[model samples]
Target: MEKEFVVIGLGRFGGSIVRELNKLDIDVMAIDSDEARVNEYADIATHAVIADSTDETVLKSLGIRNFDHVVVAIGDNIQASILTTLILKDLGVAKVTAKAQNDYHAKVLDKIGADTVIHPERDMGRRLAHKLSNSSIMDYLELADEHSIVEIIAGPKLEGMSLLDLDLRANYGLNIIAIKRNGHITVSPDPGEYIQRGDILIVIGHDNDLGRFESKLEDN
Candidate 1:
């Protein structure tokens, strides 16, 4: 079956998701209480409706439960977003992702059973800091409280070895999840994939191990 997604609050975050999902060929239903906002995504989503999601009857009428994923991106109106998430959870929506306005809002969403809660602004800030602090880090993502995935530009030390020779998992306890060469990405690269000077390694491991790897790379 084709995946179906519901985007609540047709604001920037929700609207962006709707457009991107449509580009991926996924079915998207965009919902917003604001008629103008709903109309904006009408050409991008499979369906766009102006209806207050905080109203349980309205949510039910939208067949929200049929959606495989629902994203709550309501801004300003925390009560409505929280209420909508609660209703979606109670209705057994398979997955619910919510955008938090602040720490308190995030906590409330967590308590109400939001499967994933994101602070896009805060995350972007952290990512920018990570990039600025380390010249070698191309990108970074916090996967969990104690784990992260980072893409680091390969330096001089790794220019001559094949992935098999590096044996990151056995030697450094890190996983080379992907490699960015030139402008292309090689996902789950083969053991024989040779490393070049300009390659960027997308590695995932414990935070401590990643730190150790970065330190070692810098020294080399």
Candidate 2:
């Protein structure tokens, strides 16, 4: 079955979602107050409506509640985004995802019952900070405020240690979720598998503990 999506606010984020979903052959209802933006996505989406999403009557008229998911992507107007999400939920939309400007905004969205919240700018800034802080860290993702998943090259200290020998879970509470070696990936490798000097480890765990594990690699 094709998944149906209603993307409110045809700004950069909303526009990107509309294009990508349409590319994947999913049905999308694109909404925006700006005529130019609505025209831009008219052919790309299943339906394009130039209307104010915050107005409950206009949204109801467009049958937005029928969509499987509704994404509120109002960039400049947080109030409009919040109100749109609230109306969608009240109208019994299946799911609502909102883009938030900051931590406070995310909290407000959560309090208002947003099914999911995205802080793209904050996430990007954190990744940039991680790269600056540790030249060896290539990528990072926060699973929670305290925990994260990171991709880092095996440094000198961990050159030839096997998974069992490291006993990562007992020693540091970190899990080696996967290993990328020689352009290939090993998911959930056996305990006896040996970690090579240049192998890349995709690990997940608490931030402080992961930092400790990285420092241990430096010590070895």
Candidate 3:
């Protein structure tokens, strides 16, 4: 069965998600309080409507609860975002992902039964900071407050070193969950497999441990 998604708010973030979902051939309903914004996605989305999502009647009229997932991406309007998320959950929506403005907003959303709360700006800042901090780190994703998954390019130090010999888990308290080499990805690579220069290692561990590992790579 095809998954159905409803994106409330037609800002940059929400619009991008709708477009990507459309490209994947998923059914999407785009909503916004502004008529111009709704018109912009009229041809792109399965359905596009101009309605204030904070109003329960408006959401119910659209049958939003029937959708597989609903994204409350009301940019800058924290109150509206919170109310929309709460109403969706109250209506028995299967899943609700909300964008929060700050830590307090995120905490409130978490308490209100939002299935997922994302701070895109903050997350992106952290990712960029990590990339700037180390030349080898290609990307960084926060899994929790203290843990993250980082993609690091293998350098001269890592070349020809087998996973067993590196003993990443014992030595650095991190795990190489996958290795991307020449466009091929090996998930849970064999311990005997050797790492080649330019290989991308997907490692996950506590942030402190990841920092230590990056330092070791830099020294090599």
Candidate lDDT values, in order: 0.91, 0.88, 0.94
Residue clash pairs of candidate 2: none
Worst 10 residues of 1 by lDDT: 211-220
Which candidate number maximizes lDDT? 3
lDDT by residue (78-195, candidate 3, tens digit) is 9999999999999999999999999999999999999999999999999999899899999999996799999999888889999999999999899999999999999999999998
**Pairs in clash, predicted candidate 3:** none
Better of 2 and 3 by lDDT: 3
Candidate 2 per-residue lDDT, tens place, 71-172, comes to 999998988888888888899998999999887888888888899999878888888887777756779898867899988888666778999998889999
Residue 25, candidate 1: how far off, in angstroms?
A: 2.8
Candidate 1 per-residue C-alpha lDDT over 99-181 given as tens digits, one digit per residue, 9 for 90 to 100:
99999999999999999999988888878887887778888898868799998998788898999999999988999999999
RMSD per model, one decimal:
2.7, 2.0, 1.0
- Judge candidate 1 against the unseen true structure and give its global Cα lDDT, from 0 to 1: 0.91
TM-score of each: 0.85, 0.91, 0.97
Off by over 4 Å in 3: none
lDDT of 3 at 139: 98
Best-to-worst order by lDDT is 3, 1, 2
